[model samples]
Target: MVHEYQKDDESSVNSADEALFEMLGILPSLAIGNGVPDEEDDENSMNDKGGAQALSLDRFVQRKDDNWIRKVLANSDNINLRRQYETTSVCVFPEALRIPAIEMRRLADELVWGGHIYPSDKTYETLRISKDGSIEERRALTRIENFVNYHSGWNALCNDYLRRLVSLALGQPMVLYKEKLNLKPPGGSGFAPHLDTPSLRVALGDRGPREFCTVMVAIDNMTTRNGCLRIAKGVWSEDHHVNTVQPKAEGNPDADGRAGAVLPELVDQLQFEDLVCVGGTIVAFNGWAPHRSKTNLSSFARRAVFLTYTLAAEGDFHDAYYQEMEHLRNKWRDKVGLPTQISNDELMELNALSTVPRT
Candidate 1:
């Protein structure tokens, strides 16, 4: 039941692979105890028939196979994937880079100082259903928003290449906004599964085609063990009515239970995957995709920043339900960066950023 994205010091598997040889309880020919000499000795002998060489601890440590164990007991009925379906859309950015923890330390400091810290349980913000929900505290500090609106240099780095790549992937023009930070305790989950609020919907109704996206930039190396953001792939740009679910709990329990409407029969159809990232690697997912994070299991703290963007002509989507998003936009209008126009050369460079491996 514990789903992890790719973990550090662990192996990663490819999506196209149909099976893991070990799942059938058959040891692979490559197992450590084969007849081949140990890899530690240079120029080791190889079996002419199978061309198999001995595996040294070095080779063993360097293998790149994905370690996620596929659910064998269930297929279309897997509960984990089904649970993933309710939150957001999913997409795997192949060959993602894991940010080194050393590089992420500074950003981690910023997150803690920024007052973006939350319990990951959504208890801080109250919902209409809970009598005490409205009384919940807004733990955020304005300085954090200021840093995003001003000090964050992400807009400059978004570059024409990143924008065009996003446009091509999501089939819409995209822009990079400021990065968001998350600092929660172990067993804490970051944002619950939900769609990104459009910053420009009322002005240009959610009709045909999406006009923007929010790309997540990992300030810290994200791994499955530490609860990376989980995404439901390929569901972007779909139009779904926003239905408000009233809380049935007396205290409006929390946002997690209220945000998703369970599909009991289709639970078997849901699929979830952890999207792990290295520092400097950005995860460009459809802002509308239903996504959530697993509880952190690692001993270290989890910190990440998000860069939200919008299409050139689209109205803001964040203010649809409330006046806050509108106020935030106007208040920080001067700080928002305009999406850059990309050229042909930039497009080629962006393609180079694709980290997927070749066969």
Candidate 2:
């Protein structure tokens, strides 16, 4: 049911403008061309700071004016975007955001350190124990969810620009359903082969939208050694609808696979492509894409922000989706004789007990 991004009619244009102005009124600081400098200017400014600029949320806000929208629309090749999505169910844009190197480092530090410094009910961070020959429980962070709600810079990048990019690819307006910051520190564990649609369905139930897309913006260089994402090649065909049914809960001992992951037998039959990317690269894929990553054997950390969206017409479910997921997570914790309340220290203990080291 997706189509090209045709110019809206006069009434539609008026409505969109009204919505934009209303949003601007509520978030005056986010107004287009507000004191924030352009990406090029920001890159130049980093030179004065010895290429080690302090992290500031203002640097992340790109100009979201009508002119910016027009430029984005003009640059996008809708035909090719559609063709790739239809054929492979995935698309990649290398260095699309063009964030400065200092900015990237600053952002990563903010995400990693903020969770430890200020632990709150709003923060959702998960830790993991290293599997590499060390008997000590190496507390490495694995993921942080709903960060956009706190960091204005992330909100601008994820909720505005990235969301618009996916909307262009899908040829329809989309809204944010959820966001997560995934961190794969050295010797971190990888996810088992699975489709996001099934997990999303389990969380949202019948209220979920029929179509969904996830956009990943790489904050660090992703490589084979660093556990880059690997996706099945063209597994989402009309003849086989992988989005409707949930995979079996049987775990894979060798791969350290989790419940609701695709069986190893089926995964072995499909061809997969490793999505190696440099910092600022963006990868978008449909909900049904079977994807996973490997352990981070490399010395560095692999960080990326994953933003999931559904059609705007379906309605915004950002808060509600997180609520349901938290409930399910709490239930699982209770069953394991763990506390429902999560804190910085509790996260470490939880992962220590729950995470199975990958062989």
Candidate 3:
């Protein structure tokens, strides 16, 4: 359950804090094998497309659960902060820790196998997968796209820190549900920008409203030269919905259904800015926030991962990519026991290691 942000008095706040601390103390030492103390230096061990280095989903789920708990409690102190703020987006520079290069490579290998591009990490790094062309038939790229979602980091990459940050800003309980995601590299270009479906009034019909938030972590130095993410600040407030890049002057065929509606005007007026951050920094924003990524021009690969979460009980939590691998999808379905599940506060019963500090 999310920690209630609005309480009557100081005593309650202190009590809540103490309770959360006790919970954190009793939480079991999540078996995060990658973080073991005696592990060897593995900054660059990821090489093969498929090997024994793949991350485990159990660890990812545990970490995500811990993250949800922290997020609910952390935002109680900032319940009123948004009223004074102009935009909903919040960026944290120099995030806590970097998911080492080896981990990234291990995850990247899975990503590539799942049909993502594995381009050289050099200046002008970019990811290219033809949406509708002969290039889509290429064996190597197809494999990458087919297997990326099954990889642990594909979902785990949306680390707990990023999730907590979004929960704090939105002032709501956030739950990550999407199991499948598109893996884009630096210099990648997505079709014109547009708001998410649930963000629109028309789309909100009875299908349970979409109240999702997205958290993006730059796995590399994101710079304008190398194509960083850009956003249209404040546009979400006006209508909370924006169109895609294609020009829609009242007569355009809206024909190409694959490419969402064109919002040439909105796209033009967008306040474009790159999400310039180091490898570990996190960026969070509403699903409806109008944003686009610049073309990658950096020599080093501008690798990054995105995680989108909605209220735990409000929306669908199925992995869309499970369609690609039905067996694996069923396995995950079996593991996820609850239908409308949130993080289990039971973890609070265990104690954290006193000798080891949270790095």
lDDT of 2 by residue, 1-359 (tens): 11111123312212343355456664211221121222222332344245564334354444444356546545665536656877888977433234553455566567666766533233222333332332333344566666677776667777777777777766789999877777665555677677766566556678877667888876665767667889885847435644322322322211122323565567677677999755666788987788888766543456777788989999888888877766766766676666777656655444311222222
The per-residue C-alpha lDDT of model 2 at residue 242 equals 41
Q: Which lDDT values do the candidates have, in the order given?
A: 0.37, 0.58, 0.39
Angstrom error of the Cα, residue 306, model 2: value is 1.1
Top candidate by TM-score: 2
User: Which candidate would rank higher by TM-score, 2 or 3?
Assistant: 2
* lDDT tens digits, residue span 175-268, model 3: 6643222223322333245553332222223554456566665544455554566766563643555554332222211121212333556556
List TM-score per model, in order: 0.45, 0.70, 0.50
Q: In model 2, which range of ten residues has the least summed lDDT?
A: 1-10
lDDT of 2: 0.58
> TM-score of predicted model 2?
0.70
Q: Which candidate, 1 or 3, has the higher TM-score?
A: 3
RMSD each, Å: 17.8, 14.6, 19.3
